[model samples]
Target chain A: MDMGPHATFIWTAYGLSATVVSALILRAMLDERRQRRALARLEAQGIRRRSDVAQERRG
Target chain B: MLSFATLANPSFFMRLTDRVLPWLAGVWILLLAAGLYMSFFVAPADYQQGETVRIMFIHVPFAWLAMFCYMIIAVSSIGSLIWRHPLADVSAKAAAPIGAAFTLLALVTGSLWGKPMWGAYWVWDARLTSVLVLFFLYLGLIALWESIEDPSRAGRAAAILAIVGVVNIPIIKFSVDWWNTLHQPASVMRAGGPTIHPTILWPLLVMAVAFSLMFLWLHLKAMRAEILRRRVETMMMTRVSSAVALKAAE
Candidate 1:
């Protein structure tokens, strides 16, 4: 697209926005994966939440 | 109907988000695609600013989201402090980095837009300066959360800071009117409504909605991660306590 004399500024703004937003999405996805993995590992070792343990005992 | 109590439950929140996220993602993607097409192809170049006005398509949304995200944090902080809502601090904590990212984008994009139009890359104007303060507030909240070891303590401390820092929001909004600034006064949002032509306004609105959806999607995912992290912390503490009890029994 012909962005006149200041095309550089226009493209750079869009590029930077895309970069920052993509980074945020990547970080959120990675952090969620890490937490889920840690929770699963702890559960595998029979370490469960107190609420879960209490529910199990009652059942 | 889901009650406030049910919505506040972490497990319920997690499950609900899991079901809602996929749909939200779909809508967000479609709207973003449409917004970009409209911005680049449909919106005409300004007679005065020329094509540089294209930058506003993204810049304005980023600027709006920056304030919007901070407002979310502040409201969540209030919930954390007063009602002691279980999910409130998680909401605030998850929102900090996202809010910071948006604020940084707003500043950088504004600078980029300013250089060609305003003849400088940086300005100490009221609107710009207040926004800078908002960015620092986001950073302070993030640091406060990270510095403390205990989650509850960290949440309380961060909540206080978030609440106190919220005064900056109104200041940022009214800065142009309150003080002479290179930045233009409110156009899209004002007493008479948007001054921009319809061609530019439509794409801007579409992009704003798309950006908001994107924020909501990310915030939900971050909150889920936080809930899991808390669960892990509780389980680890229980294990340690059980081991100590066994050692004492010996």
Candidate 2:
């Protein structure tokens, strides 16, 4: 809707909030994806989970 | 066999979160959509403040959640220091940046709201100042975590700082009433009831839920990344150890 005189300030605040929040969310998700990909690469080279070793030792 | 101890293991945690993450993501998306719809269109503008009053939907939620997240950090810090929970440090570390970002949003939006109303971009009022201090506290915590080489030691140091910072939360809460200030006193969270009309109150509450869900989604996702990063670190250390051992044998 038309925000009248203070439209600039209003839009700026909303725009900034959207940009920052979106950036933070994107960073978190992308960082997780990056970490997952790296972990997969390591696993491809036979890097096993510490938990797997622990279970093996217990058994 | 979902034992708590096993769940604390990073691999187990990764599996657990991987299952739930989609749901968390879904909920946040839906909530934010509903919140934006209500906040922008459904909620009527304030009689005096006019269109600018719309800023409340975002600013108030950010301010509330910023404080809430700091408390989360403090509690996680305690969990890290006292119980030495394996995931405690991970939770605290993951929360810091998110808290700091929300606090930054709060300060920025609050200033934007302040300008047309207060006729100034900044004020040294108790509420605003205390919240500013909270932002610094968040930054100091993040810096503390990064500066220390050891995670355990960093968590302990940060925990003590967070505990001490608890004193400031009340000051932020009561600052408008405690002193003569340009900031308005609590209308929504007061003793008797919310002074805000239901038309405005409902959308604000919806926006608050959206912000909270957004925070949880980010925190969980970040926690997953941190766990994976730790796994990589441990793997690297193992590789180095084995390399040194092989050299010794040769």
lDDT at B155 for candidate 2?
81
RMSD of each: 1.0, 1.6
> DockQ for model 1?
0.88
User: Across residues B1-250, which tens digit of lDDT does each residue of candidate 2 receive?
Assistant: 5787897776677787889989988888898899899888898889989888899999999999999999998888888888898688899899999999999999999999999988988999889999999999999999998999987788889889988998888999989998998899999988999999898999899999988988998998999899888887777676677789999999
Q: Report the C-alpha lDDT of model 1 over B1-250, residue by residue, as the tens digit.
A: 9899999999999998999999999999999999999999999999888998888988898899999999999999999999999899999999999999999999999999899999999999999999999999999999989999988999999999999999999999999999988999999999988999999999999999999999999999999999999999999999999999999999
**Leading candidate by DockQ:** 1
lDDT of each: 0.94, 0.89
- Cα lDDT, model 2, residue B230: 81
Please state what fraction of the native interface contacts candidate 1 reproduces: 0.93
DockQ scores for all the models shown? 0.88, 0.77
